[model samples]
Target chain A: MTPGHLRRDAALQTVLWIAVVVVANHLASAIPIRIDATGDQRFTLSQAAHDAVAHLERTLVVTAYFTADLDAPYHEHEAALRDTLDALAVAGAGRIDVQFVDPSTAERAEAAQRAGITPVTYTVRAWDRQEARSVFMGVHVGYGDRQMAVPALLSIPKMEVELVRAIRILTVDPEDRRKVALLQGHGEPNPADYPAQHPLYQLRARLGERYEVVQTVGDAPFDEDIAAVLTLAPTSPMPAATLWHLDQFLMGGGALGFFVASAQPDYQRGTTFEVRHGIGGFLGSYGLALGREVVLDRVHNEKITLPAPGGRSVQVDSPLALTTTHVERTAHAVRSLRSATFPFAAPVVVADPLPEGIQAEVWIRSGPESTARPGPIPLDPRLLVEPAASEVAGPHVLAAVATGTFPSFFQGQPPPGVRADEPLAKGRLGRLLVVGSGDAAANNVDFVLNSVEWLLEDPSLATIRARATGDGPMTPPPAETAWRWKIAVVAPQLLLGLALAWRVRRRRLA
Target chain B: MRNVRAILRRELIGSFGQPIALVALAVFLGAVALFTLWFDDVFVGGVASMRRPFAWMSVCLAVFAPAVTMRAVADERRTGTLHVLATMPVTSFQIIVAKWLAAVILVAIALGLTLTWPLALAWFGDLDPGPVLAGYLGLFLAGSAMAAVGVAASSSTESQVSAFLLAVVATGLPWLVGYALPLVPRPWLGVVNYLTFEYHFANLAVGVLDSRSIVFFASVTALGLRFATHALEQRRLA
Candidate 1:
């Protein structure tokens, strides 16, 4: 060929190669494989997600009502939500249909609201002025006649777990879904009596998404259908017969979660008083004790906004509310908890020389710079005195789980009302999770949800939540220590460059 | 392969013979440290991650890679050494590949200097080696792609400053397009966004070694080397 023809041939080859590359990129994007190099595999979908869609008997239709033109931060969440739904759709094997609708218009917005998807209002600054913009970002899923809505897309990392949870709710068989009993009639916060902002209401509402939350009177025998029992902040003692019934329930291999405090604090009065839920003796049988001491921490604490002497508010880091990142990484219930805070928390200690066949594990603890003292504790955040060097002994156990074949607390004891021909001496295998602070369950929804799932022997959903919780908050080093580290990181490179330059100049001079 | 290695060796030695390369290395290190430590607030954020440092290093390479490659071919052509290189048995492909390879090595050296950041993080807390390795992998890919583009720009221009400017624009437009996605029309949004460097860099930054991102970078590197080779052949024809 001539030189011009050869050049034309070369140019055609280049074009063809570029076309091949473009097509390859398109094909690669179409493939569903993404290697999640994170140690925790945060980006990869959990097995639970795959399983949730793998056996879809009916079409799971998901309608996402999200404004296309949202603020920058919402953009990431929208993309992640779409990606997760797309993955689920692919896993559903033609049983899932996904659609995205912009609910910007009023008619569409009204339709979305009817479907329980609400618009979130955000204020934006543009052209030297601030203006409010209302946007809809919510998901509605339907399987058969059952429907569940993820009210808002607030967290990007949490998007997958929330979507999977909604799908699980829609797909789970009605008979197979477990019932969670909230034992009441002893001054525990009831979901029915509290307002929307109450922690009990929030806890019940969050659990209601996954389980059938039922309020059972504590004075009677629990329904046999109850898979787990949760008792939160019982301010009064249970009846003798009721305690006996609880013991019998445990003897029947039921899972129990106790979130109670030995003392109750009245923040308005700036004082605390000891209160007994009458379960201390009951817990003592299982090798766990409800300590009366209130644990306070100096490190890893949250700031609470309090009314100042003036009309303004002051944010003070209160030791009474302890925030702990020291969670047990191995436990399924607590592994995904980045940090949990316990307000007016007490100690839950395992009995010395734990009972035979009973294995207990501490799931949560206070920071190293913490102290636990017996009540009545002062409720005033400002008036609490600092602990002395001798008093600063902690890393106190705030929560624990014990599992074994528990010996019946009612062993050799007769029935409270009726004479029994035979008294049960031993119980079957059971699990008991105890928390020092009732407020923790009311406050940290994830902790209670995961604990319930652990009790029910269903940890598939917890793994999904763990994938969302990528990493815990870092405890930054002291200022001087960080400065030292910075110098250590920066100095060697500078010095090496200078030394190499000097050596080169010296060789030239030689 | 032998011709490529000989050309690569010559280019590397010629690069280190000058004092400017050392100064450039120092500047890259100082800027990366400043941006990562002070601006990114890695200490304040308190996450045990080298993500911030790697991110700032990627930003630094946008300018640093071009500075390293601006003189790769431009200085030779300006000195009338292109004719000298043409007389050698080495093909234009070998010369361009060798030049690009040398620039990538310098980029790697600059990235290697920041290893102390990860070492410090690991010393302080539980640093997962997976994300750290993924981060370095991503930085190397992005930095090498930028270096390749710089070599192509240098082959087209006779002045170092002109070459640097050309390379910066060529490499930067792709990243800047990501920020302007809001302006892109709905019909062409995906196509335009796919051309952006940020779109691909972000996937790798999150510890996701995605196949699409790898393919995209490889394609960019190949296109850059091809353009540089074509420019060399044009000089031969002239």
Candidate 2:
């Protein structure tokens, strides 16, 4: 063959090979098959996500409003979001439709705003100038007549949780969702105070996704629509009538969750005030009672930043801040948690020789290396040193659950303004979940949501939400150990150089 | 297969017998350690993962890989040995594959030496071995692709310095294009992002061994090797 013809044929082959590679890569991207090797399998779709979309009765459409001209992290996040939506579409087996709309133009931006998708402004550095660019990273899902918007998807790690939750909300029948009441007459922190970081705000938001979260304030009866009642850390004593009404609510088979605190610590005053939230006595009438002491665990605990000298703060592992993995294995609510944190918790004890037909179990407890100090204990970190062997050898109950016919606190004795025959003495079958710490309901919101799901007997999605944990913070090594590790990691580079030099010298000698 | 293996053995010995290979390996390992520890503050971040090290090593291999492959074909061509080898039974494609494999082995060694970080993490904290192993796999694939680009650049040039610079610019473009994503036209954003090295490496770094990303790196390696073979063929035809 002529040299010219040979070169032309070679060029054609090169072009064809390049085209083959491009087409193969493009096809592979569309296939959406991935092997998730992370310990948590974070990249792979969770069972909950698959379940959320698998049995979709009607077509579900997920519309993602993202700006086109995004920079590094945001661009990467958008790509990840697309991949997740593609995975969901594949999981749905043609029931799920995904759409991407670039909301860069003013008209589309306004339309996106109307759809509850908001834009986050980012500062971009252009040629010799810095400009603020507003970009949209919100998602809207539509199923049947209902539509829900994930206002802003700022976190890539939490993208699956957000999308799955929105899908679940949009697809689930409105009539199927139960109602949960949060009692709020006695100075309990408001769950609606989302901006103020009220601990129960997280719980309220999560519950709002699956159930109707309503406030039951000032002698309001627990309506039949209410499947559960949660009284979160009420500081003041609940009215006699309110306590009696709760007893009646429980008698009617409504689940009750009392996240109670025995002592309220005032960080500003450096003192603790004893709280007599009447719910404690009410719970005591059942099989479980909250102890009037603050529990401290030195071994299984979390770190708190305390103000130190020289205008700085140092993080110290505070015993008052408890973290435990000693949760009930059988209960679906707490089983998925690697560890649960209950900061500044009290103790709960099951009353021995319990009432007839009542079955109670302590589902969560502090570590064996723990001490419970009776309130009003001082609020000093220095006073939290390791207790003596006699004082520190108990697994204090941090949370307990009881399910049975609960005998009413106002069984025979009616409260003021109540007729003698008004209250039912023994209630129907009910469930009661009591956590010894109010802070836990907020800090461990997943556990709270899971508990509610377990109470309602729908714990399917609990595991998926729990798996949203990106990665746990590493247990900080001691200063000496950290220094040793840093040296161990960096020193090998020098050793590699030394070995190379020796090899070079040996070769030269040979 | 035997011809490829024989060429691979010769390439490995030829590269390692010189002092530059050892220096390059040491520099690559040291650069990763310094960037991840001091720059990324892996200790302060306190997450038991090899994410930061793999991220920094992607940039390091742009320089390290070219340095390893610069003399593979360019120095032989300059010394007229490539023509002598062309007269032998082995095809230019086998030579290219062998050189690429040798560069990949060097990259593997460099990545393997940095396992101490994960080891210390596992000893002190909770280190997930799956992500670390996936990250090593990702680095190896990305470095192999870059090395193929280096071979292609070397095959086209008689000057080793020119070949190194050419490979550096070619491999460095994909890594640098990630930063310029915002400026890329909206019509071409996805294609431009897909062409980037970090875009494919990002999932693998997080332990998602994505089939698409694997295909991307494989395609890049094939394209590089094919380009090198074509360059050699063109020289012989002339």
Candidate 3:
């Protein structure tokens, strides 16, 4: 009860508290939190990290190359790195060791250069708001012999995906070569457009694990060396000869991932937003011609808006419409976009009549506000042309699945340069899918992953939204129309009266 | 009324004392930078930049609100301060209501600062304020409700670590439950998951701000506030 005792007691308490916090911080930081929200066969980053670490394939080393110096413009990039390293360390438990390397060092620079990794130079401006010069943000993730270089970790999107990929590359078998193709020729998105340093580019590096990836152009040799043909933005119109070759290739049942933006009219205007590409000749050949027009779905609009002709009156544009669906008749689907903009568009019309024995099932559609448009628009300077009232009309298909016996664009035989006879007898016994718009394929994988799952024959991945955008026909009969009363009485009466007056006028003239 | 003021002032004052509030503020700013610099190119797929900051601000709210609210009540209870407050004349309900209100106010301030994002975007290109407003409103409601869940989980626990983890679990449960249950074979999966907070939060995320989503979020906060009050009362009884 003495004063001396009280002072000592307080000091002891402070020391104990400090000790507890230090130990707690280390222990907690070590405990990797595994998130497995994706149920059934889905391995989240944490789980993947755990599995890789537990395997202890080798000394799985991970080096984080973010500069923690405050003076760096990329100082903003630190938190994500901190959180990610923390997460990785936790998942690795004791097996996977991580070192946060300040890649700004000469030794570090030399290490990165020697790793066969290019220094990802990002132009970082100063946070001071006065002098702005470019700085770089880069990170390396991997183990002893191999490592993955991540240029930057800014947006939290797919960091988990990237991390999982890195771990897989470090641990997986050497024989498992991933077959990926940046499909050649017809304006497919270039690999460079993947932002050579983007996480997607890293994804390509990881996929190089299990498949032989060939960036193929044109359909000629359909190389035996090629596993899948990745056609992003096919620049040249695929001649009918090419289509015939593709048809036969598909008949051989090779995995064909056509990320095509065949008729995205917005590209012509020097802007790429507000676009919906229609698979006209291709899908039309199948059974449906996804109207190559833009579709507007009020049900789901991106919570984005843009200015219209009259500055005061703003137009509601849905930029995030890819995944966010709003609940309204305008969107008229499983979800609606809360944001709106000129960028997100509907699928083009699937109007081409289906060839005999082909069945096309639409995997994704725009809201009731869909509109299809024609295009051969230039992709450079990406922009949607200034909209006319006519351009706004839509209800087009952006993506769909067509499966049947396909008629070869090259019906009878091979082309002049043909060498070996690739098999064509198995053409329509299986399914071939034509996506109206390829936007959902690249980048929007978070939302459109379900569509890819369905396309890949994973049938199990047909998960949500695929239950169907809705049941029953998308549109209703005239009788069920809310304005049916006006149509029944006013419209008919006016027409009849006008006809009668015209007759009377004719009789008078006689 | 006096009890609410005392609690609010204590919460507000406490938030300023530690570097926690400043850290959250800094993180918010960091998010703005990311939005301006990177998200434009990445998120919009190089098509058209968002040119507005609200959508990105909303994403920040999603990450930060849980971190802020996790320690709001749980830290108090863990440090034995909840017991001190419980002994005071203040009712548990007043305490819970005051804390929730303060958290929401703090989030709103964060969002207010983020509003400058659209202006920054506007300086460079055209922007429609309607979606920006809707996006802000969405961020506010979604953030408030998510923070309330954090507060609720915090009140129910004693350790800040557990509370932080639980807050994440609590806020994220809606996404997991809503998206996961639908994939289940159970017949009522749709209806059940639809009832989760995300089904409604997502609605507001895109700017619909449906009465149902509003009510649902309000009810969640109210329900958590009430439950927290009960937890405080239990402490008093003990």
Candidate 4:
């Protein structure tokens, strides 16, 4: 071939190769293939997600309310959520429709709010300035008339699990839902009265999505259909008949969740008064000692901004508001939860020799630098400072669960002024969750929801919901072990280098 | 095909025959081990993943890969061996492929040696081989692309230092482009991200072998080799 023709041909081949590569890459991007190598199979869709998506009888529409141009980590989170939704769509076999809505406009923001999606405020670095931007990172799932919204998609570890659980709950027939009774007659906020600012409003709404929230008024025998009962901060003491009703409910294999407080703190009055709801002795019979003292965790606690005499607000780290990471170590209900905050919490301890057949597990505890103050305690903000050396008391359990047949406190003798006609001696196999503070659920709704779910014998997606995402805090190895690893990594490489040098020298000599 | 194989064998032997090749290999391994162990504290972190080591690889290759390929064509030209090779029956494409392949093979060997990391981790605790294999694959593909750029740079310049600098700039520009992503307008952001090497490599590092990423690296390798072959042909024609 002529030199001119050869040069032209070579240039044409190069251009052709470049074009082919670009086209091939574009096509490849259009089709994605993922292989999850994680031991947890984090990238791969869980069986629950697949099963939930496959069982969809009607078209499920998922609308993600994500604002554009989010900052680091959040931007990654938005992308990860989109990718997860796409994977779910693929897994759904055309039953799932996914849409990404930028809630930038007021109308769109309002629409997101109406759909139960809340926007989170983010401080983002934009163009050499730190700008406060309200970004929406919630997902709304709708199937038929049923709909559920995930208010936040902050963590990716359990994104799929949360999405699947929401989908499952939304699609399930309303009539088939289980019954959960809320014991009332005390000063506990009514679940039916859902004021947005109410602490239990979110919890009530979340539970209502999966179960029928029934109010068990004043010692009424739990309806046979009730699966569980929740008693939140009962201010008034229960009558013997009411206690008997609760025991009989346990005898019928019902789950009981007690968010009882030993003392009720009046922040305005600057004092806490002792509270006895008459269930403390009943819980003791189940092998859990409810301490009459409030726990103060200096190490793992929250800071409260209190108004000073000079009208200045000072942020003081209060031991009374414990922010603890010491959750149940096992893969239990609290497994998925990273941490839970309990305000004015008392201490709970399992009996030295737990009641026969009853297995008690400490589900929540304070940090090592924690102490308990005997009530009636002062709610003075001045006393909320760091604890002194004398106040240190290792760690204290704030919540516990006991499972098995519980011997009733009234097994041998009934309470004073009560006529009992042959009360049941031993209760049926059941689960009882005891939290020392009613305000435990005030900070994290998932803490209470997970406990209730576990009590209901359905801990599906609980662990996944609590999974930590993105190179989660690495457990630092001991310094000595780290040194050993360094040595182990270096010694062999050095030996290999020396061997290579020796081989090269031997070749040179030859 | 026979000419390509012959050229490939010669390139490989010629590159490995020098003591500098082993030294470079040792330096690469030692740098990776030191950075991962001391700086990132992979051992102290107790994470049975090679993520920390793999994360440092792209930056490491941007510097070392050029050193490996700097002499591929520049030294040959400086030593007056390029004309002799040009007179041979082999095409410039074959020559460029051979030189690029030699550098890539060296990088692959270095990466292969780093397998001891995961193996050691497995001995100590549970190690997921999936992401490890994926991470190694990502590094290999990324290194191959860098090798291609280095070969092209070497073919363009007769001075090894100039070639090394050219190669570093060419390969390292994409990493800088990755940081410029937030500055790009919303509509063009995805396009700009797709053009960068780190975008594709990061995807692979996460164990999601998106076909686009594979095709991206493959395209980069092809583009770099194409440029090198064109450079060789121009030199011969001149």
- The CA lDDT at A361 in model 1 is 92
Candidate with more favorable, higher lDDT: 2 or 3: 2
Give the Cα-based TM-score of candidate 1 against the true structure.
Answer: 0.84
Q: For candidate 2, write residues A126-219 as lDDT tens digits.
A: 4445678788999999998899999899888789989998898888888888888888878788878766366566668778888988898637
- In the range A1-510, model 4's lDDT, one tens digit per residue, is 888987898889888988898778777777766666554566777666777788778899999998886665455678789888987898899999999999999999999999999889866544455667788889999998888899888877668877887998888888888999898987676856878777689889888878988887645567778999999878788888778777777766889999987887665666677887777788888898788888887656787655557667677777778766666545457654556788888788789899898998888777656788776655555665645444538478889998998777677566666566744545579889999988786667887888888989877666455443322222234444667777776677678778877877787788
Cα-based lDDT at residue A85, candidate 1: 85
lDDT of all the models against the reference?
0.81, 0.81, 0.52, 0.78
Candidate 3 Cα errors over 4 Å, as ranges: A1-56, A66-95, A102-138, A142-144, A170-175, A182-212, A215-221, A235-237, A259-279, A288-364, A367-370, A373-393, A402-422, A427-510, B1-238
Tens digit of per-residue lDDT, candidate 1, span B20-112: 678778889989989987777666544566767776887788888898999999999999998899999988889999999999999899988
Tens-digit lDDT string for candidate 3 (B1-238): 9889989998887775555765776676676656644554212311112323444555566667777777777888778887788678987778887888788888887776554444434433323344355456666777888777777777888787787788777776675665454233334443454456555655444334355555556656665665566566555555
Docking class of 1: acceptable
The prediction achieving the highest DockQ against the true structure is 1
| Reference contacts reproduced by model 4 | 0.39
Error of 2 at A91 (Å): 6.2
For A1-510, candidate 3 gives per-residue lDDT tens digits of 565665455456545644554454345335534222221212223444455456665666666665544232233246555666666667666666777666577787677556444554443332223343333355566676676666555544345545555566666655554344555566555544577566446545434543455676555647654555555445456655566666576655554555454434342243334332223555455465544444434334443333345554343434223332211222122121222222334354444465776666554444444433444322321133343355555344555556656665456466566544655546635455444445544444333333333434533212222212211112211222423432332343345435645655565578
Better of 1 and 3 by lDDT: 1
* Share of the reference A-B contacts seen in candidate 1: 0.44
- DockQ measured for candidate 2: 0.40
Q: Summarize candidate 1's per-residue lDDT along A1-510 as a digit string, tens digits.
A: 666775776678678878888888888878835788888778877788999899999899999998885654455667788888887888899999999989988899998998899788876543344667788889999999998888788898888888989999889887778999988899788876889998767878888877998888756667889988998888898877667767777777888999988777764655677777788778878888887788888666777655556567677788878888767766767767767889778888889898787889999888766788777666556666667343447888999998888766666484567336434435778889899888788778888889999888899888878667665335455555678778888988988898879877886788
Worst ten in a row by lDDT for model 3 chain B: B42-51
